[model samples]
Target: MKTYTDTGKKDTRSGFGAGLTALGQTNPDVVALCADLTGSLKMDEFKANHPERFFQVGIAEANMMGLAAGMTIGGKIPFTGTFANFSTGRVYDQIRQSIAYSHKNVKICASHAGLTLGEDGATHQILEDIGLMKMLPGMTVINTCDFNQTKAATMAIAQHHGPVYLRFGRPKVPNFTPEDQNFEIGKAVQLQEGSDVTIVATGHLVWEALEAAKALNEESISAEVINIHTIKPLDTDAIVKSVKKTGCIVTAEEHNFLGGLGESVARELALHHPTPQEFVATNDTFGESGTPAQLMDKYGLNAAAIAAKAKKVMGRK
Candidate 1:
């Protein structure tokens, strides 16, 4: 097995903060709205720099979405910030009706998504937001992998003239990828190329997928890892090509198995190629209060689980 370089650790939310600040300077029309989660969502930099352009709505996520949608009417690109649960499930109607339905240029920036939110428990940790947002019309759903990619996505989404759901996490994990990498929405990054199996993952699970790739390599099983950041407008071509080469698939995510990244990939693969596939994700249940590692192990979102699932998917029975 070959050794990969280890980058320093950093939280993905910081990337969003950094990108928002850079966007505030680059685009004067960019406005920010927060539901009293500035620190959690890491929007303080943008709020402090562009105070006049930021609206602190005081824990009212629904109201913040409405205001963000309204701001889009006057040539303002509003970014509504909050946690994943509140960003989507709590304000689905507002986002669906006012933002997606009305065609508002609002960036729904959600932090602390999935089990990595750690110690928040099930009430706040939402694994279904991707499915919820992706179902909406004209909504672009993105779950960035690391700090740099999230920053790049946040900056790029500001230039896109429509509604977008940008999801990131709170845990300080591996910070791979280039510092100034250009983030192209709807495009997936091919991490490791292989022919045995393809592992598609998003958010915190991308690092796990990388770890699984190393493990698979040690076991003499070549596996391709694809960072599927954009769940809504999935990279169908990349998935098709990878599956065609690999002949099997395993999906990993820090989200629920029912309506998250894995399901999206499964739905696409089912149509294009009926390949053997397995999913390493949380089943139909709520999250629990524990350390990130504990929850990940319990919910089967770690590297070993992904590797095991990959072996199973390839019919290594």
Candidate 2:
């Protein structure tokens, strides 16, 4: 298995902020709108440097979405920043009508996604955001793994013309991916090549999946690890190719299995080549108050959980 070293521990939201800051410098047409959580989302730098282009929409998330969509009509690439729940669940109607349906160049950058949001509990931890956004036509859903990937995805989405849902987290995680890597939409990154079982992951689970691969390797099992950053326009070809070699898969994500990455992979595999698949995700349950690590472990979303699932899925094959 290929080894990965953490450059440092950083929150993915900071990555989004860094990317937006860079866009503020280069892309004059790029504008940002935040719904009362500028510091939380790490968008203060963009607001500071590009005061004229930054829209403080206050706590009205729905209004923020409407404003972003309207700004796109005037050829402005608007990136709306807010919590995952408020970004999608609270403003679905506006997004569906003004953004996705019309194919507006609006980027819905969501922070504090999934169980990693922690302490603030289920109300803040929006596990269903991925499913909600992915269901919208013309909306590109991207759940980046770490700081570097999140920054890359943020910068890449600014260039893409269409509605996009970019999901990131609050808690600091291992920032392993290269700082200067090209961010390709709908393209899966193969972290390790193996023939025993394919382990596909996204968001915070990507690092966990790598840890699982290492554990499996020590056990003499060759597990393929693929980083799936884009959930909506999934890299079906990579998934199919990996599964064809391994004959089974283990999908790990921080969201629920009901409508998250696992479901998407399962659908793709069933249509192309049916195979035994296991999921390392929340079992259709809500998150509670705890630290990020505690929630991940309690909900069975840690590296050990992923490794256990990989072993079980391999046995079924």
Candidate 3:
């Protein structure tokens, strides 16, 4: 079994800020907009350095979407930053009509996504953002795993045309991936290889999946771990190839099981290769006001939960 070390703990939102700062220097056409939550989204550096390129749209998230779409017409790459709940659910109509329908080159960078938003409660936490964004035509949905991966994804989206939904979280997680890694949209990163079971994870669950793989190894279970950063345009080929070797699979994510990564993987598997699978995600429920750790444990979204699911799925095989 392969081992991964956490160099340090850092919030994924900070990675976005760092990436945005870098973009301000290199990408001349890149512009940023924030809907009142500038600091929360970690766009302070970008806003400070590129004041002329940054727009504070106040609390009007829907209006921000429209403005971003308009800017895209002028050939400016606009990255709109806000909470996931406000970014997607609050302005779905504007995004669908203006961005997706027209294929605008707007990057909707959402922070404080999923249950990791913590004490902000269910109203602020948007677990269904990935599902909502992925359903739209020409919309690329990416849920990055760690700080390094999030930073890489932030920079990568600028080069890609069409609308994009980039989701990250508030809680600091293990910084496991390479700092200078290239972020490829719709590409799955294979963390570890095995033949007993495949553990596919996205967002905050990627690190947990790695930890789960280690636990599974102690029990003599060889678990293949894959980090699925991009939800839409999912790497079906990678999933199919891994499942063919393992015969069973387990998916982990911070979003609800209904429309999250697990459902997407299940669809692909059902079409190409049927495999026994278990999901480690919120079971169609809203999160409450609590610490991130507490929320993760209560909702069974941690390493222990992932390991147990892997074991259960392997049993069905």
Candidate 4:
């Protein structure tokens, strides 16, 4: 079994802010817009440094999407920042018609996603954002794992042309990945190799999956861990290849199981390979106000839940 060390703990939103700041320096055409959450989204630095390029759209998320879409026509890559609920649910119509339908080169960067948006309650968590965005025609959905990966993804999306939904969270997580990682969209990073079971995870759950793998190793259960950063344009080949070797799989994510990474993986397996699978995700339910740790434990979205699911799925193999 391979071991990973946490360099530090940092919020993924800060990584987004850092990436935006870097883009402001490197990409001349890059512009940012926020819907009354410049600081909450960690986009304060970019807004401050590039005031001319930053548009404070107040709380008008729909108008912000339209403005971003229009800016893209002028060859400017606009990165819109706000809470996940507002970024998707509140402005879906604007995004669907203006961005997705037209295939605008807009980056819809969303912060405070999933149950990790502690004390915000279900209305703000936006667990169904992934499913909503992925169902769009040309929308590329990305759910980054850690600070380093989030930063790398934020920078990488600027080079890609098309509408993108970049999702991150509020709570600080273990920063385990390399600082200089080459984040490739639609590419799955296999952290550990095992023949017994494969664990595919995304977002904050990626760290939990790693911890689960470590615990499984202690019980003599070999588990393969794969970090799935990009949800849409998913690395289907990587998932299929791993499951073929293991004959069973476990998927973990911070979103709901109904319309999340687990469902996507399940669909791929049903078509290419039929394998036993277990899901560690919110069971088609809304979240309540609580501490991040409490919410994660109550909803079974942590290492213990993942490990137990891995063991259960392996039994079916």
Which candidate should be chosen as best, given lDDT against the real structure?
A: 4
Instruction: Please provide, for model 4 over 1-317, each residue's C-alpha lDDT reduced to its tens digit, 9 standing for 90 to 100.
Output: 78999999999999999999999999989999999988899888898888999999999999999999999999999999999999999999999999999999999999999999989898898889999999999889999988999999999999999999999999999999999999998999999999999999999999999999999999999999999999899999999999999999999999989989999999999999999999999999999999999999999999999999998998898
Per-prediction TM-score: 0.97, 0.99, 0.99, 0.99
Over 4 Å off, model 1: 1-3
| Whole-model lDDT per candidate | 0.89, 0.94, 0.94, 0.95
List model 1 lDDT by residue over 257-313, tens digit each: 888888888899889887788988889888989988899998888999999999898
TM-score: model 3 vs. ground truth: 0.99
Off by over 4 Å in 2: none
- lDDT per residue for candidate 2 within 1-317, as digits (tens), equals 68999989999999999999999999999999999999999999999999999999899999999899899888899999999999989999999998899898999999999999999998888888898989999889999999999999999998898999999999999999999999999999999999999999999999999999999999999999999999989999999999999999999999989889999999999999999999999998999999999999899998999999999998898
- Please report, as a residue range, the 10-residue window in candidate 1 with the lowest summed lDDT: 1-10
Native-vs-model 3 lDDT? 0.94
Greater-lDDT candidate between 3 and 4 = 4
Q: Hey, what RMSD does candidate 2 come out at?
A: 0.6
